[model samples]
Target chain A: MSEKPTIEAYLKNIEEGHFKAYKCVDCGMIIAPPSGSCYGCGSSNMKWAEVSGKGKLVSFTVIHVAPDQFAEEAPYYVAIVELAEGTRVSARLLGFDPLKPEQVRLGINLKLDYEKGKSGATYLAFKPA
Target chain B: MPLNNTNIVSAAQTKFGALTGVTLREIFSEAVDKATIHAGIPKKDIQAAFIGSFIPEMLVHQGHTAPLLLDFAGLKGIPATRHEDACASGATALRAAIMAIESGLYDTVLVAGVEKMTSVSTSKVTEALAAAADDQFESSIGLTFPGVFAIAAVAHMQKYGTTEEDMALVAVKAHKNAATNPLAQFQKEITLEKAMTPRYVAWPLKLFDCSPISDGAAALVLTSNEKAKKYTDLPVKITGTGQASASMNLCDRSDLTSFSASVDASRQAYKMAGLKPKDMDFAVVHDCFTIAEIIASEDIGFFKPGEGAKAVRDGITALDGDKPINPMGGLKAVGHPVGATGVKQAVVIYRELIGDAGPNQVANHDTALMHNFGGTGATCVVNIMRRADL
Candidate 1:
């Protein structure tokens, strides 16, 4: 078994532009954002595995009313991206017109990217590949 | 025999809306007063208390609320506990109270849910509600409650050909039902054009699609069946109660079109009651968002998958429809006071079951179901109620 992946480490990797997920040592299933136990096999034995950072947009929403932290960045896109590793994660969908959701089609391929928020914090993001 | 050992002697709620200047303790005590008076039971008879209030510590700067609220209501010194499951907090408290009675621990207990949200700003309320979602995965990425349901609305629209108008129709029905409900927040019917005209809160979910942040509270007095006769002649038997959950994050879910927790919870309740969806005269589900109502209608077996939208369009879920849903305006028009909503759902159903619902009453109200969920379907509670004589 390899070292267990922590959210801090997973996020630090994303900040460094190297995205990774936790893979169950018993079932070889990829778990994103790190979990104590794998949902598939219920295994606590997991290791870090770098994902291809490529996925398709399963669903998306243009947030016009955001929480206070992201209030300045209203009218941004938040989407559920189905990673190529068969797991899904929520990330900002960049490179799209927020005002034109009619044109943003689902199932469109997207590659991993990052966006610096108003708080000067790095966030996981994606754009059209 | 069904699980009919426990009965609700009475239930009551404050008019849900932006109740300005009302403190948490005041509203909760008001609800408790109304319920105990209606039940014709002395406050001293209450053995314990289970209260539900979500985010009050943040919104009102008050925690350890169980005793505080109970003490204000003049029921001080009884064992009390606060239950929190985001929007489902009230129902979770009710479930706890019911179990306490069923376990032979208490003959009668008080169950109440309250939330004073209008005291805070909208953004602050939004941030507080976001706490219900997974902070690391969903909320940190900027997912508001409306955004969470908007994602589901988009997925359902894609797979079921459910148009935005169909979603708007739900708001229309909600407003229509609430028009006659004197206690409802939105008491006037809205045209389809009006419902669709509101600006987007999230893509595909307009301003009218989401439930409002309001201040209110609801209370119920539950007693064992043997002791129920001492209170009221029309006690409503709680035949079935079910609670289930799913992945907290929407991304972890395999499908967004329906909430599996509702399905599982309703199934458990139905089995316990020896009833089916068809047997339920109506349902008051958690319609925190318009799309959520559509999804819940199908999830609880009132309609097949992808059929809930059509049901709304056809007026099949209206107050006079074959299977009336949200006959008392629901959270959409009734105003969702977070913790109060779950208990309020039971309050509405209990009134309908006992023929106490005024102008908003449905023709067929012998049996009903109340479904309440917290945080994008992560926590769901369903309770089936029937007239005691039945």
Candidate 2:
């Protein structure tokens, strides 16, 4: 039995300015932000590896009405990015105006980035590579 | 699994428009009393209870609600349970009660779903509802329900050439039907131009496209097949029930145009009922947004993958169409009281199928299907019901 990795550790690595993902030792499936078991092979045997930090925008939405915590950040862009590893994750889309959603295109090449929120917590974001 | 003749003998719901000053428990009790009394069943006859609520605590600062609701409805001592699956909570509760009866654990069960959402500001309500999404991934960054579905709408448009005009047609149809539904939230008809011009909540998804923030309650009196005849001869037989869960994040899914949970759950439902989608005379789907209706139409196999929008455009889903969907105005106009939406669908279908939809009933009425969906298709509950004579 392998020791399960925590999300905290994965985020901590990101805090250290390194993008790390868990790859299934059995099937080579790369999962960002890690999981307890491999979706492809159900293998507990996993290893932490650095990601290429490259992805493409699959879908996105401009949240005009934000939550209370994100009120000042209203009209922000959030999108799902499909990474080079074939794993998808939701992150903030930077380097663009949130009010102008028509300008953003799907399948656009992007690179992994980070943004600090009002709470000073680091969040995953993507920008034009 | 096939429901073993667990039938809804009587179903009732309060008017689904905005109502103020009523506690959540009061709304629940009203629905339970109306349904059981209409079923001609004594309070003592209900052996168990199942309730569904979403963000009730956020709206009213109330929690541990099942007991209080059951007690208010005069069924305090019976074993009671609660179900929460985002917007599918109401149907989840009904499914649990049905299973309890089918498993021989109880002969009769009272199922209720209620949500009092109008009490708070829409911003706060939006925050509470965003809990349905993955906080770490989506909502934490301010992704609301409208945004998630809008992204799907955009994907559908990119792949299928579905236009904003096609989506607007869905809202037009919903409002046209809702104008006739006495209990609907929006009781006025809207033109295609109006739907198109409505302010945008998210790109490609406008105010007219989104289901309104509603507060309401719905309840059903269900009993086993053997005991059903004692309550009513016109019971709605729940022949099939299928529930499936999916990844909460839409990114995990391969396709953004359709909900895999809906496809999977409907497959299980069709298998259990010994029926096919073509056999459905009518259906009430989870049209939380205009684009959602189009996607749901295809996901449930009523239309082809991208043909759902075409079906909407061609008027194939209208009240007079070949396959009428959401004859009772659906969530778009009927009002989506998250927890209550699912059970309300059942109640409306049971009433409409038995020629009880008042002025809003469609022409077809033999076999019907009801779909309840939770958060971006993360969970879905699909059930096939038939009039007892059928």
Candidate 3:
């Protein structure tokens, strides 16, 4: 068992150039972006562990109309990436033209990465590996 | 198996649109007044109030809204509580009122839902609406409601070969139905060309594919079956209701093509009513986005999975079609004032069942279903209502 996985700690790890998810100590199931209880077997016993950051592009959307916070980054790709650990996470999808969604292919391999927003905050992102 | 306990005596709502300069209290009271007056019941008869307002705290800087709106509606000195489950806030409130009546705590109650969204900038409203999603995983990463649905739309398209044209047809149908709905926001029909040409709000979801941000309120008066007889001869009975929730984050869902909570809720509602999808005369489903309605059509079992769009293309969901849906235009053209939407669905169904839907009236109104979900299908509420005489 290690320090409980809080979103703050998860981001802190991301900011430090590491991607970690909660691995249920009981069932060995991975819970990404961290959760107190395991979705697999409903156990709260979990430990922080690093993931391979490898996954496939499951589904995606190009957001032309963004929220106020991300207005400056309009016309960006947001995608659901399934980590090789079998857990899915939503992240910024890069290395593709958002305007031409016809070219973006699903099931493309991707690797976990980080990007900086206009507000100088680091965020979890994914790019074609 | 039907819920013989509670009946809807009356339902009312302000025109769904950008009601500029209209305060929440005024619109809310207006709806309350219309419902009570239509039912011919004095406001004093409402034993308690359950109100729903999704993001007034962000949109209008108002909190503790249950008492504020209730006081303005002359429903003061009664026990009032507010319910919030994102966009399904109103249905949650309605469910609570139903349970309260069933529990014998109160014979008569009022349920209301409202939102004043157009008062703010579009970007601000978008930001406010995004709060409904999981902030850490979804909204915080720049996912808007349109974006969330777009993701689902893409998945549905991929798995079922549902084309963008299939989705555009939904918008066209919504506008056509809305043309005859007096209280709808957009009363003019749109061509498929117009729907297809709109810029992408989120890819696979065009601007026309989305519902507008509006301000409005809807209220319903409910009483036990015995008390309903004192009001109107044509009371609509709420025979079945089911509310269920799923993971707050879309990433947690195993499939993006359909919403599990909707299926679970509708199944529960159908079982309770002792009815099936074929028995429903019509439906008022949450069409927050065009794709949502298509997915909802399947989720409620009206159409098999991946067959909803085909049904739409075949005119099966039109006003005169075999299984009409959103005969009052739905959130698409009716305007989605978030919280008001769920309550408005029931209002539409009640009017249809009572033969008051005017030009949008369908041939059969024996029974209908209303499906409303909050956020990316995280919270879903399904209800079946029928004429009490049935």
Q: Against the hidden reference, what TM-scores do the models get?
A: 0.98, 0.96, 0.98
Candidates 1 and 3 compared: the better one by DockQ is 3
Cα lDDT tens digits, model 1, B65-180, are: 99999989999999999999999999999999878988899999999999999998877888788889899877887878899999999999999999899989999999999999
Pick the winner on lDDT between candidates 2 and 3: 3
Please write out the lDDT profile of model 3 over residues A1-129, one tens digit for every residue.
Answer: 378778888877777777798899999999886787898899998888788989999999999988767889889999999999999999989888888898988999999998788856677899999
Single-chain TM-score of chain A, each candidate: 0.93, 0.90, 0.94
Q: Considering only N, C-alpha and C atoms within 3 Å, which residue pairs clash in candidate 3?
A: none
lDDT of 2 by residue, B307-332 (tens): 99999988999998998889879999
Q: Chain B in candidate 1 has what TM-score?
A: 0.99
DockQ of each: 0.84, 0.67, 0.86
Residue A48 CA displacement from its true place in model 3, Å: 1.1
Identify the CAPRI category of the predicted complex in candidate 3: high
lDDT of 2 by residue, A34-94 (tens): 6778889888878877788999999887777667787777677888899998998888889
* Model 3 / residue B370 / CA error / Å: 0.6
True contacts kept of 1: 0.80
The digit string of per-residue lDDT tens for model 3 on B1-390 reads: 778888899999999898977888998999999999765889989999999889899999999999999988898999999999999999999999989999999999999999999888987887788888888777877888899999999999999999899999999999999999889999999999999995999998998999998899999999998899899999999989999999888888899999999999999999999999999999999999999999999999999999999999999999999999999899999999998888999999999999999999999999999999998889999999999888
Lowest-scoring 10 consecutive residues by lDDT in candidate 2 chain B?
B135-144
- Candidate 3, B-chain TM: 0.99
The order of the candidates by DockQ, greatest first, is 3, 1, 2
